[model samples]
Target: MMHKPVVDENERRARQEAHLLVREFGAEAPLYAAMKAEKAIEQKDFGRCARWKRVLEILADEPPADLRRSAAAK
Candidate 1:
């Protein structure tokens, strides 16, 4: 029997958010979002930084925006 891969809630959320952002912002969404997170970090806002970091975890593994657009087109 084959085992199903375990699903990660954070990863799932990141992908879904990636799709939404790509659609909304086109090519720049991922970088734009990352910049926002970076800004949060710079400002020492732990709460916002934590939220963005959580959503951005798998974003590096996944392509920034183009991959998201192609996958959503399917």
Candidate 2:
């Protein structure tokens, strides 16, 4: 019989912290939200993906001034 490997305490704590960050920040944490969104997409979970996309939309940063000005000039 194969024994289960032990979980490292620090790694566990870090995972917990990351989970908390996702819970607290949702889409405001773009990297975390994007990761979740990608996972959702991979899982074919459209609803979950849409939810994450909404959060991403809400928290998306404005374009830089130069980009905005160039677009305006077009």
Name the lDDT value of residue 55 in candidate 1.
54
Top TM-score hit:
1
| Per-prediction TM-score | 0.54, 0.45
Best by lDDT: 1
Per-residue lDDT of 37 in model 2: 80
Tens-place lDDT digits, model 2, residues 1-74: 99988867644443343344445554346677678889999999987787666545534543234223443454
Query: In candidate 1, how many clashes are counted?
Result: 0
* Candidate 1 C-alpha lDDT tens digits along 1-74: 99989867755665666667767766667676688689998999977776677656645556656656565676
Q: How many backbone clashes does candidate 2 have?
A: 0
Q: Clash pairs of candidate 1?
A: none
Predictions in order: lDDT? 0.68, 0.56
